[model samples]
Target chain A: MTALQLDTKPNWFMANWQQLAGFGLPVLAIAIYIGDDIVEGGARLFLQRLFDGLDNGAIYAVVAVALVLIFKATTLINFAQGELAMFGSFLAYVGAVTLGLDDVKVGPIPLGLLLSIVVAMVISAAIGAGIERVLIRPFDPSDHLPVVLITLGLFLILNSLAAFVWNVNPREFPSLFPARNESGAQNFVEIAGARLFYDVIGTYIVLAAIGLALYFILQRTKIGLAFRAVSSNTESARLVGVRVGRVLGFGWALASAFGTLGGALVAPKLFLKPDMMALLLIFSFAAATVGGLDSLIGAIVGGLSIGLIQSVLVGYLGDNDSAFIILSLAVAFVVILGVLWTKPAGLFGTSAVERV
Target chain B: MKAGSDLAASPEALWSEVEAAADAGWPQWVRTLNRTVLVAAGLLLLILPFLVESIALRRNASLLVLSLGVLGLVVATGKAGLISLGHGAFVGLGAFAMGAFVDLVGLPYPLALTASFVTCCLFGWLLGLIALRVKGIYLALITMGLAVVFPSVAKRFPSITGGTSGRPIENTLDAPAWTGLTDSQTIAVRYYFCLVVCIAVFALTRNLLRGRIGRAMQAVRDGETAAAAFGVSIVRLKAGAFGYSAGLAGTAGALQVVLFPFVSHEQFNVFLSFRLYAAAVLGGIGAIIGAIYGVIAIVIVPTLNDIAGGLIRNDGRGLLDNDVIVFGVGLILLTFVSPDGFAGLVQRVGRRFSNRP
Candidate 1:
């Protein structure tokens, strides 16, 4: 068994502006054009593409972070994470319709939003706990595939159950953030002669807040320490007097809560439905992989990067049939190769020893 | 030991005991009951064609293709412990291969079927190689990605694939003059062909599970490391299982194209993969009979929903329209209440009666 190794030394270039500029310049040029049109709307298109990518990336980050939390404690990827989020969104929709919360007369925004969110979170957490107790507890941890199969089974069950209960109608969820007026939306702030969309500004703020809150919780809390301990070695932690089951329960609950928030944030943009998060989950998986599944910070960074790349690709490469697929494949290939080569543990993931 | 001793003394002694019992009881009634069941089965088989309305038969004919698809899943998830989320891609491959062979290469139907099976086997082989590298969740993800990417990949070659709209195959199985049957009768013959093929596949799968290879697969599923120590080539077994699964899925696809006369990427999407998984679990994941039951449930449940919707005049709007919910709820209930699946539950009850006190 090889001992776990931690990187202590940080490169000055990682912090230096000059090095960042050198790396950014080439990316900027590639973002401009390739074998396609270079003259018309190229530069403006590139910036818009970048913003779109960031927005999508922020969504992925939310899902990836939820996945990371569960993975950290359980070392099992909860396949039902996406379904839980979908369920939450469906609940939000249900709240809007049945309770008359979506009505403007109730308030500027529906009263159901708050009630729905709380209910969704509790329900999601209950689901998380129920799965852990019922499906997961019976299986041996070393037997990874059976647990995975159980989760897959859960995934199927949750998706279908949600559909059955709510129906497959796509409901428009009320946005948490108020929509901007037409005049406000049309105008863009000029920055260094480049137009900056205000929506992008709101997205960044939300993403930044999530990132900061996550960092503070993970880095500065006793619960976070316990989480890390459990993640690193469950048996050892148990030997050291940690209630492993409760920790797992908490992990799942935390992940579900995160998923609830994620669903609430993104569901309004896309109409809410049972399978709303199916495609987004794939993107989140890609992000999680790229960010290094074990690293919370890595998930955020990877998600943002993926979002940016996807948006830019869509903008510059055009919405040709093969483009998005090829881009995603390429990204996945790069991440897999990168992990296998320079860092098998991931960019932000801690290097660990494998004992056989 | 007592049972074995009784068995050893059985031929003459058993006959005498049977005679005694027959004298005491109504042996003719037991025989009559068995005969009645047999007669009922025969009559049902004979009357099914006559009873099924033409329109219902048409719908059922198309449903058989999906049933066959679910059967393929039985081999992969049931016997092999491999979860393939890209089975639709294999189905598509087989369908398109059949089309290409029949339309472009000008091959006969039988030869085209063989070509489709062989091509799908090769693709399955490649997928199996990937499965060998990564087990469980990663394997599922890879297979899903393959399914997701298949449509775009198919679209890239529009001339051969017919692009997004998909290609239509000419019906090669027409009513022969010698048969002297009506159009519906000829279609019924095709449906019977599909039913026979499905039954044959199921019987073959049953036999396979009862054989040494089946035991080896079970062992591997239970414990790979232990199986390896027992001299089972883990890689070969898994890959072979995957190949077999792909072949079955491909055959099902070929059958689908024959029945429908049209093939498209839209028919074989990631959602289809999820449905297959749901069906497998609904029927009973590890049992051969479970797959058949699952396929029937998958086909019949939504169909019932549609009927119910029509009767109520609701049009099955909203969630009723989405079969995914039905599949999902069925899966959850099956897992939570009866892990062995609906078929397994039936089998258990049957066993109870068979072993009556």
Candidate 2:
């Protein structure tokens, strides 16, 4: 079995100078290109853009982490991850909005919405696990075509199912965090004249909590050991008496939970829709690829880098033209190409050795 | 398993088996039956336009064009063992290029078609170059990115693409005076034109796949190291397959312009790419017949959805006949039942029938 040396560390700048330069050069060029505006407005505009980018980066990181989890465990990319997350958001919507669970309370605490969201996440996780067992486990892992096809199929089915069930109309999803005070002043902390919304802060805190929970689960739990063992080598893990199938399913469940959280966090901003996650999927893929598909920490870094690049570069380039509204997507595509070209294994991923 | 062993032991023997199975292995009666079936199908296709409504003809033209796109997937993913989730982008590129050349360059329809074909081939070749260092899931990621990014890029050029609303190209491939068809009646002419082009492309593809190049592609697909050891240039083979596949997709795009005379960025969204992949799989990857079946399934399923959707339309809300759901279910079922696809299913049936004698 090939060991990934997940704990072994390389100097960040030394290991990823090429990637840094690639992302940095673009931001520099874009900054120079829009120098006049930056000079006139000072660093306020730039700081605002950076904050916005980081806010978006947090969402991508959440989704990218989900992607990395599955990749680490099964060596397969779940193309349907975004849709699964989107579906989870819909479930949350049905619970909190349609069913009016948000109005329910427990002794001076309105935790009903939170409870509903957790329930939605649990349902989505179960679905994810079932998908692994029923659809994925039967296939030979070495043959990638079936897995790819299956995931792509699931992507389409889940997306369409969401559309059918919820219809295509955009729905307003209430933010998890307070948007405004009773006096109607926006609830945000201003840093350098840039308003960092409470929702964004809430998202980060939730992500940190998730990271901590995952850390405990993986480090201290028995299933975590099994999952790590299976991810490293299914054959070896099986030989060592690890329930590889259950561990793989657990990985899927964890991934789906994270994905649901991402979808719910971003829905308030993007507006809940069937196709809301479509573009986000591309961004998260770029994030995952940049971070190394199998590295959790890498996904976070990649997501932030991509988000910053997309926001700043696209913001500057599309300054003069409304036609370039979706230029961020193009930036994501370019980032994927650039990262894969210079470093195929990504910034932190272990390079795989293919056998003849 | 036996075929794998045969391929490993002797490439020549496997090559002959592939070549002669349809011709020499089948009995004379079976061959005659196949011939009769082919002749009947061809004749039916020829007369189909006359019998069907213009809308049906239009749908048939769409089916034929989609088949070409599916065939491209069959060539690249099926035959050459390269996974491309972005052929939809190539198809869109061809459509937009055809629109541009014909409208802006003032070129003839044939010239426009040729130009679109060349443009897509070059574009695919360039993408293939960028992807030279990557393969497998990474390649799929890149291609899918291309698909996702293509529409936004296309929309940037408002003049050429007409921005978000899309532009309509002038209909230049109208029926000749000899055909004595009215303007409205020209639908048949368009259908026939697409039909003819489709047949030619299919024939060329069949020839290409059955020859030496196809064998080399299969070899690369089966084992890159072995193929390289046997002196195949992996780089050239992969790039050529991509270019060729893109060319086929481009031709399909040109035909689409012929049928609809409209090009839009919205039409080339990522779902289009996914649907193409789904159709390619459901029809059976790598099989020409499978592509046809796939196109049939894709085209018919939507119409069926509409019909079923209308009947089951509760308060005009729950559209149970959604094509996406059908395709999703179809792809999953096909994968579980037989990854070889409908084409494989047909082959199994044929084997059952032929083995009896």
Model 1 DockQ reads: 0.21
Q: Per-residue CA lDDT of candidate 2, range A1-356, in tens?
A: 33455433455567878767876786688778878866776687788888778888989999999999999999998989999999999999999999999888676444877887899999999999999999999998877888888899898888878887788899988777775443676678898888787777887787688778878988899999888888888999999999888999999999998999899989988899999998899999999999999888899888888888777667766755553446787778888998898777888999889754
In order, the candidates keep a fraction of the true contacts of 0.21, 0.72
Q: Which residue pairs collide, candidate 2?
A: none
The lDDT of each candidate is 0.69, 0.84
Among incorrect, acceptable, medium and high, the docking class of model 1 is: incorrect
Weakest lDDT window of 10 consecutive positions for candidate 1 chain B: B21-30
TM-score of each: 0.78, 0.92
| Best-matching candidate per TM-score | 2
Which ten-residue region of model 1 chain A has the weakest summed lDDT? A1-10
Which portions of model 2 show Cα errors greater than 4 Å? A1-40, A105-110, A180-183, A320-325, B1-38, B177-180, B310-314
Give candidate 1 misplaced runs (Cα > 4 Å): A1-44, A94-123, A126-171, A174-187, A192-194, A319-346, A350-356, B1-47, B148-167, B199-216, B226-232, B299-323, B342-357
Per-residue lDDT over A1-356 for candidate 1, one digit per residue giving the tens place of the 0 to 100 score: 33332232244445545434543654676756552543465666666666668877888888898898877776677777898888876776677667766663455444566677777778888878777877677667765555655666667667766666666688877765555344545545666456565555656776787788777766698776777788998889999988888778877877887788788778877788877887677777777766777888888988898787676654556566366755665554444433333344456877656542
Q: DockQ scores for all the models shown?
A: 0.21, 0.63
